[model samples]
Target chain A: MVSLELKRVVVTGLGAITPLGNNVSQYWQNLLQGCSGVGPITLFDASQHNCQIAAEVKGFDPSDYLERKEAKRMDRFAQFAVCASLQAIADAGLEINEFNAERIGAIIGTGIGGLKVLEDQQEVYLTRGSDRVSPFFIPMMIGNMAAGLTAIHTGARGPNSCTVTACAAGANAVGEAFRLIRHGYAEAMICGGTEATITPLCVAGFAAARALSTRNHEPTRASRPFASDRDGFVMGEGAGILVLEELEHAQRRQAHVYAEIVGYGMTCDAYHMTTPIPGGKGATRAMELALKDAGLFPNQVSYINAHGTSTLANDVAETLAVKQALGIHAEKVAISATKSMTGHLLGGSGGIEAIATAMAVATDRIPPTINLEDPDPACDLDYVPQLCRRQQVDVALSNSFGFGGHNVTLAFKKLKG
Target chain B: MNKQEVLEKVKTIVAEQLGVAPERVTPEANFANDLGADSLDTVELVMAMEEAFKVEIPDDEAEKIVMVQQAVDYISQVAN
Candidate 1:
């Protein structure tokens, strides 16, 4: 029997290509300054569409990180994954050569991978002919191609998989990678989420479902989590990646540890396809499970990076969930929804938010929930409204809920001497 | 179409599919060795040729047309 001794996992590196900025530092700074990244939709001609706003990652050229031939073969989501993974690998400074390549792995999750290519190919098949479709269409549009392409680019050949758990995909990916290292399957893992689905079909579908915010004129203040006049979530595109190294591996290499990952808990509501459970029952249990997994008390959780997607239903329900999970201590926890600035990256949101949570644990300065000028009466907790605060945070939790009733909570603790 | 026209069109297709420059797509250049095209690119290149010239270069024929000149010649012959 293989001994499954749990090893401590630490976040050694972080990378992000978000709507706020292309790198982690810039994204962090913008989040701290309460800057909104939402803007007019320019990826396509959205004039005919109802929702004409999104949080698109601006000025990201694939040539900066990928070779021309390599870039041409990948879908936009895969490109984002590869770029962010490479960035994370570089930031970790842990070399991946012939010797150490077999010990490292990657898991990149995406909500909808290659939707743009699928839509484009369908058009080509209709307008042109079926045989005229490019041979790369199938491979380009698959969700797992992100992890597949990342491995080919970086030469990390351990275990790899892609999680498609909608909004919880990123957090799920990090959790799975943590398990892989904890169980001694691999030494380290590159994990996170990437999503580039601000295309016409995705936008049209979300708009039809009434899941997207229609505040075109006021795109900046549209995503108001825990606010009274809040609307639906604004579609955002980008990727966030983190390097999870075993404690011994990270310490031996003298890695700059951001924070120690203590616990990961996930549960499914099993109730709806597009809506979360009423009163946040599943989400509440997810938080409790994470606390139990980490062997920590509710009072120890000083901050929470709420999944708060700024939707009417999600805000109220998540508020109820947090209150239920933390009991009386929920009122004291400083919770902030970074989605107010980054505008919900869907699957990619968890990755960037995890980075945010780890940063909060490492630095003790939490990013604010911007655009929360009017807090909802039901949400009476301190949202760290509109301003970054300096506080001594010992433990942090990142909560992510997906469309498929998936709820994930990741606990990060400030590494002490 | 004549061989020169076929060559020019093939050069454009190769440049677009293989992500290479038109100037580098000489008649003697091999698709895999010179242009760094794997099996997937070759398949797509053949599909593009079929679409552009309205000629079905079968799988067996595609395997033989590994060089730029072979593709241009094959298309010129098939089209003409």
Candidate 2:
């Protein structure tokens, strides 16, 4: 076994443009209140689609975060990423001057980048001519533009890249950022995931795959994770970004530390593309690895932000994974599926969920899994049902499982001193 | 369109495409040096101008039209 010497990394700032709320404070407040962001799809005409409801970032005007021309040139995902990055930079109060500019980096993840832009450009190409397609189409539609634009916006001339691991992309990005800082690759990193795929093709494709909830009549209660009646995930669109800095660097700058990221573990099932292995072997190993990396036992984990996507297979498999990984301690951990309220933000889910986990570690409050009216027997874990729970939490784990059998678990611990 | 009409149209297109106020879009303003436009933004501005004027500016000529007045002159010469 290779002994690794890593620097300490801490999260100093959090930003979220989520369905629950626009910023971190509002998102956290709404999560504690168990608010649901799902509603009838107003982005486009979803009347014919089976899953018509979604958790869209309502009332988001790109002009609010960017100039009219800049907003026009970018896809919604990149817009959210830039907006969230700005918010996080401001919250961290770290001035990027000539001295430290090159030491800062950015890494953003997206499952599907600029799908809406692609769809619209394709339509323009078909109806008009190829030349009629906006010259901004290619840049706006590429997934890496979020990180590229974010670096340009923040003036961070350091490492810049994007991760595209389906739903696990966000967590993977954050985990990679943590490693970068911990390994002395950079002093600080802006990392997260952004996704805005609520387009005609995305909706139609998910509907065809039967991966979305069809509870069109009651939109608010659509994403019922770990519940017997849960049908499927409700699509959500947003971005979540965090400013991760080396502990000494953050301390030198006198930044406010939200929580210390202790460990990160990533594994692939290699079993299926869209489904987990029956026993969640890959997920269990990821959780075990994260705990080992953190130097903590299973009983030390007080809360879990589960990747309970409301799919029948995932919920049960995740429960089994947790049980296998934590044994009897699984019963004591307060696990909640925030997707029950925010719906599934796809790649954005891990970033936002990690924020939620950090906040839980900082504030000792666990958000509820709203709409879990009847628990599924196979998923027989304490899912911190419909009401928020207030309990002192020292260690928290956030899990994200993506398509292509990617599993990531991030462990965050409360600041000791 | 006449010179004055073309200038006005060019100003409007540049103002809208660059997210700058009409007053800021002076005839002497260089798109890259003055208006904070990157290469991609310049390309987009050219595309928007092409769509507005209904004239296809060749890539070689588009590269030459850097300033607002330059775009106006190119559009006026080609559009007719």
Candidate 3:
């Protein structure tokens, strides 16, 4: 018979390769400073595309983390996942020796995996014959390769899996990993999300959907979340990985706990394909469920890393969702739209936002929502705009909603000990 | 291509594909054993050799190329 008692989970390590910066320290520093990572698309010539601005991960050299042979075998997304996972594992100092190798696991998520590979290989297949196509094409383009490659690089032999729930994938991965540790499935999990879909096809596809900002001249100010003039989200790329350990396991290993992950809530609109349900009811329910799961009152939430995608729909809907979930305290809460600085990282957003929330909980500082010079009347919540806010953040929530109306909220609390 | 010319080109490909130094990719070096070319790596290496030499290496003939020298010999014999 399984024990009814649930184990406490804590975030022992964090790693990120984000648009604002590569590592967690750099990213967090830049975020607090309200640095804008958006620029003219350099990965590809955007002269012909309708949407030209993107928040591409700058100055990331795969050789810094992986050998040439191994890096060459994986796609850019998988490379980011492996590098972030390695960084988090090192930060945790949780050695995967012969005794504990089988007790750890991995779960990495992605929105669209390796579009560059698919586009490149498709060209090869069309111009040359099928035989000329690369043998690594399939493995490199698939979404699950991130989890698979992370596991292979980290030697995590327990339960290995991947979540492909669009933007909510990263949150789902983290939540499921938390579940594994909360129950008796695994002692630790290297879990999060990675995305590198700033390719021509992705840009064109998003442009066709009118889901991207077309502010080519002013790239830095393009992703103006909760702003009245906000057009749409600017495409961004990166990865975030966290090492979640059981409370007892972390105590035994003497791992430094950043914060405690107390709750996760997932919901689907079942209403639309891309647009969120009216008033973001699904998101409201998700936030409510997360608070309920954590056994915390709405007034207890101090900071919220809002899924502020800068699109009119997301900003307005997310604002309403917060109001509905938290009622009067929603106005008092310090909400942040870090997407203004990092841009929307798609699947990677949830992972990095969770890190941001945990950082707020641990450090008592909230990063600002840059470029929010004019707030939309509909989104009149305290959106810690213009500058970072130094406040007492005891409990924080990170929200991530995906293309499939997938809503996920993760609750994090400051470790009192 | 001459046998010596093919050997140089093959050595360069092997070195690049296997992520090893040129000195490590000797003519007698086995792709898998010495150069650490896994099964998939060996396939890609053969594809690269086939493209460079302008020759189609049949699957059966490709399987026999266990060493670097074998690739050079096959390309040298097949290339116009």
What is the per-residue lDDT of model 2 for residues A43-127, given as tens digits with 9 covering 90 to 100? 9999988889999997777777787887888899999999999999999997888888898999999998999999998999999
Taking the tens digit of each residue's C-alpha lDDT, what string does model 3 give over B1-80? 68888898988988898899999988889989988888889889989988888899999999999998888888888885
Q: Rate the local accuracy (lDDT) of all candidates.
A: 0.92, 0.92, 0.92
Question: Which stretches of model 1 miss by more than 4 angstroms?
Answer: A1-3
**Clash statistics: count for each candidate:** 0, 0, 0
Winner on DockQ (2 vs 3):
3
TM-score of chain B of each: 0.97, 0.94, 0.95
User: Which parts of model 3 are misplaced by more than 4 Å?
Assistant: A1-3
**Backbone clash tally (model 2):** 0
Tens-place lDDT per residue, model 3, A223-295, is: 9999999999999999999999989999997899999999999999999999999889999999999999899
Model 2 CA lDDT for position A364: 91
Per-residue error (Å), model 3, residue A143: 0.8
Over A213-304, each residue of candidate 1 has an lDDT whose tens digit, in order, gives 89999999988899998879999989999999999999999999999998999999999998888899999999999999889999999999
Candidate 2, lDDT over the whole model: 0.92
For each candidate, what's the DockQ? 0.76, 0.71, 0.87
**Candidate 1 deviates by what RMSD?**
1.4
**For all the candidates, what are their Cα RMSDs to the real structure?**
1.4, 2.0, 1.0
lDDT of model 3 at residue A121?
92
